[model samples]
Target: MGFNMALLALRNDFKKWSFILWIVIIALSVYVFANWGAQGKIGQPTSVIASVDGDEILFKEYVE
Candidate 1:
């Protein structure tokens, strides 16, 4: 009975740590993604060369 109680406590602790680890992983992923594509623009207009109807065509797309 004592061994069972210890095992149960260990399992609960493992679950708690797993939850914290997942939370940390998600937060880090969000932080990285938020900053991933923010390095090039310094308050400049995007590379759009033309607009048709209401859709703007990017220069990169035109080149491709």
Candidate 2:
């Protein structure tokens, strides 16, 4: 469907839309968080330290 029609449909069906919007936002958040370390690049991480292979690791995306 076209963009305007899709949004218009949602407006006419608000009850269904509330549920659908929630689900879509949740799904999108999951996808984003899952890809965060790979693609997300922003925000502030104060310490920025973690462990790997029993070794203390820093920076991001391994030492690679």
Candidate 3:
């Protein structure tokens, strides 16, 4: 039925595109595998490590 037709069409497409599709899939897999640890290397606590002002430097005191 429809499944058989789809199978036939899929086979045709595979014949036409198997090589290009394989290249694309291999490239994507390599890129993904290489960048697998990139996520863990991001979002680190990049903080301001120094301060010169006093602890009681409030906005109300500065406004007066």
Between candidates 2 and 3, the one scoring higher on lDDT is 2
How well does candidate 2 match the true structure, expressed as C-alpha RMSD? 11.7
Find the 10 residues in a row with the least total lDDT in model 2: 37-46
Where model 2 places Cα greater than 4 Å from the true spot, the runs are 1-12, 38-64
Model 1 scores a TM of: 0.59
30-52 per-residue lDDT for model 3 (tens digits): 78755754654333333344444
lDDT of 2 at 60: 47
- Best first by lDDT, ranked: 1, 2, 3
The lDDT values for all models are 0.74, 0.73, 0.64
The true-versus-predicted C-alpha distance at residue 41 of model 3, in Å, is 9.2
lDDT of 2 by residue, 1-64 (tens): 6999999987889978898999999999878766774663435354567788888877644321
Query: What's the TM-score of every candidate structure?
Result: 0.59, 0.39, 0.35
Worst 10 residues of 1 by lDDT: 37-46
Candidate 2 vs candidate 3, TM-score winner: 2
lDDT by residue (1-55, candidate 1, tens digit) is 9999999999999999999999999999777666653653334445657888988
Q: Which stretches of candidate 3 lie over 4 Å from their true place?
A: 1-16, 38-64
Clashing pairs in 2: none
